[model samples]
Target: MEINQWLNSAWFWVGIVLFIVIIRDIFIQKSHTITHNFPVVGHIRYWLEQIGPELRQYIVANNREELPFNRQERSWIYASSKNENNLQGFGTDQDFNSPGYIFIKNAMMGYNPPVNHPSKKNPGVLPATKVIGLFHNRKRPFRPYSVINISGMSYGSLSAKAVESLNKGAQLAGCYHNTGEGSLSPYHQFGADVILNIGTAYFGVRELDGTFSMDKLKQKVDENPQLRAIELKLSQGAKPGKGGMLPASKINQEIADIRHIPMGKDAISPAFHAQFSNIPEMVDFIESMATETGLPVGVKSAIGKLEQWEELAAYMAKTGKGPDFITIDGGEGGTGAAPHAFADHVSMPFTFAFAKVYQIFQRHDLTDKIFFIASGKLGFPEKALLAFAMGADSINIAREAMMSIGCIQAQKCHTNHCPTGIATSNKWLQAGIDVTLKSERYYRYHYTLVKEIAEITHACGYEHPCQMTMDDIELSMGDNNRTMTLSKAYGYHKTAIAYEYFNELIDCPHLGGANARNRLSR
Candidate 1:
């Protein structure tokens, strides 16, 4: 009776209070929970990025003793930028007797060496013209450059500062800079040479409904005297035989304005050209564009099938409608953004496709008339030499150039947060890239690297880098499957030089000594 009476009094109220306290502890909130120590606003990532370069050298950077595109590439950039000796002070880290690496090609005892220059039957390539070459008439056609020119990289894909820097650098080097599938921004106009890429997304020069505008393209060409080449990007090497799409989240007002695209809509670039299906149609497209503007029109492809190449070649020959050059990109080539599968495994490797395409041109007797430009990881002198040796008239290097100017190649070019300011769609990040400092570095990198390529040409028993031929290259069994020279290998081949040396007359100019031949141009 006493307990029941107590339950209805102060004791019951105390019990309820205790129960409320227990419920709060278990379900409502916990005062003792752990919390991560961070700066105000949780800026750990940003702060980390602020010190990323230093931390990376100590942590994630993979070291290299003798590999190309390794620590050596970085070291070379540093040394060249400061005008210091690029060679390490220490003795060679490489194996002196290693036959696995092909270093140089040497001559046999009293071997009568013959002069081997690059192909002479090249198309007329005027550095400047009145109109965009692609829209010009083909009757008395402009000379086709070797099918390879720098592939598309728009100011939007990269920073405006970065694009202007690259275009200026390309102008200095007498090569072409592709305005990536991005719309031609105002800054890209500063360069002396520019090739506008019309991407599937049809950015920049597109209509309100997202169709291509020839009139806008012509106007762009007329406005920018640097606009000399036009490339129709049907498909890329990294994502061949596939369509292209960009998320709406990636599209901003700047991109929309440059690309002539509406905001808040998914960006789509269909895999195949809506207006072109067969080779004949592709030719007509090229011819029509050439007629529309007086500039070189070309196609950049990542070869998907052998039959397709054969058919395309046959059609071009049959209709007498040929693209000035064919830029055959390797599947392993780099890109700002693409599906992982296509970048890694979808298309033919450069070695395989390079040989096939070279053979195709030779077979059709179009080798001399149509130029071949090879792209895909060709940023270094050795890699570029390899492409030239594989029958490329010229080659383009993109990522390597990025590397020379402090890009860590985090493969985050698709992201606007690129720490180096090389590739980003954002302007604040673009401010990080100082054009003056970067452009001079670009000049140094080009001169030094091209000089190194000329050295390789000389080591291969040639006068100029352009004088190098495929027969001059030999594959090694090790590290790079390295292609090298006879002197570097120690074991020389007489059979390799037998036909050239034995068949040629000693006094002939065609059999001139390597040094007596053409000058290596700057």
Candidate 2:
């Protein structure tokens, strides 16, 4: 018989039947629920809910609001973030066809000012070191503003070129670049005056065997005295309690070594640290790191439940073991690859968090001991002023800076195929980014914006940008009916809180569960 005839025989039919029976026995039979119920294995639903959706919504871009970003806003950031030419036609990609589409006229009443001295001016100067808190008067003794700094950004998530470019920009701008929880990269070493951020993973500075390494941490920081600060990243705005995750594709020899991990596998930072369990214990670890390294230390976090913040604050107040600075990331953070649920459902938007933390610090009267740096969309002159008004000692802008360097605001940061070369890690793509060229825009954006904000402070009748307070102006109506005045809008000045506040009181859903007061009592 031919091949078909042979295969169609009884024995062949029996063989196929046997294979199906075996597969059914092994996999499709039953006990799938049992297999899934194994601790984190069952947590698929939770993970999917937290991060998966936001990522999808942002990537899909169906609606006008960019989900995570608005279309026009994202475009503006991408264009200005990069150091490339701002090339476009008819002003924007916005459709004039739509009835609701609003456009600015060339002869608009306002005089748009040009940047006078983009890179020529001297950097802002104040004191040799920053002093936090002016809570007390000093006929005998009081306090001052602290030289707080920015926290880390993972080298793995960010391109080597991007990180280098940021380092140059930060150094010129007299700020610190954080070496995010993915651990420190050798590239970060070049920007040596960094704040060595020991993220939850303890990725870098770990021994070859995967334990924490004091020698490595010290060696790295000690070598560069400019690496003047340290921050223990407890959590982040994108997904708090959720640690760092590096896909196998992004993990390379350099990353593996810096993070002290094996090759050929994605690195997952455990949600819980092996060393510390509770908030107090976490503080102890940060204190240990700071003491061990002889540098000012702090923790980075997306503010959580109020009980935790109060307990930690109370404990720190009791023990005098608080970190030097508290870097507060509002929930509206994490532009990189993150689960939608985490970004949307879990995180606290920065405006509220920053204000809450400021209140908490004042409540504990710890404002002088610790400083606050606000992240999460801290861009645009207007936005920065708002952050300052909300009591953020320093403001940071990642996506905004990306705009100055010629980003088109694609918001496709997770894809290494970032057309602007601001987010991708591909070697060939990275090679094309000339740090020298990008640095100019970064410098220009920082200087120009600072000046613009300073102008706002002056317009509002203040001394410096830092002096821009809540009592300055009134909120007016939008062209339609959408406007909130300054005094009535931003919690009504630093000392005047119209409502109750807590740093860690996050409502995963706006509907609410735990109240801020409840958390404090707990």
Best by TM-score, which number? 1
lDDT, candidate 1, 215-298, per-residue tens: 887787677756666778877776777766666877778777877878998777777776678878788877777667766788
Q: How displaced is residue 315 in candidate 1, in Å?
A: 1.6
Residue by residue across 1-522, what tens digits does model 2's lDDT show? 689997979998988876665565456646555333443333455667666645655665653555455755655444544433434566655544443232211122333323532112332311111232212111111011112223466777778887777767655544456677776676665442466677766887787566788888878766665555677777788788776667889888888887889998878787667778887778777666766776667677787677778888788777777677778888876645567788777857886677666676677767645656778876665666666666666765666666655555556777677776767778877777788777655665665555555555555654444554565433444345444545465454564322111121222211111121222232
Which 10 successive residues of model 1 have the least lDDT summed? 122-131
- TM-scores, one per candidate: 0.72, 0.69
Q: Please estimate how well model 1 matches the true structure, expressed as its whole-model Cα lDDT.
A: 0.61
Off by over 4 Å in 1: 1-62, 65-69, 89-102, 106-150, 246-250, 478-522
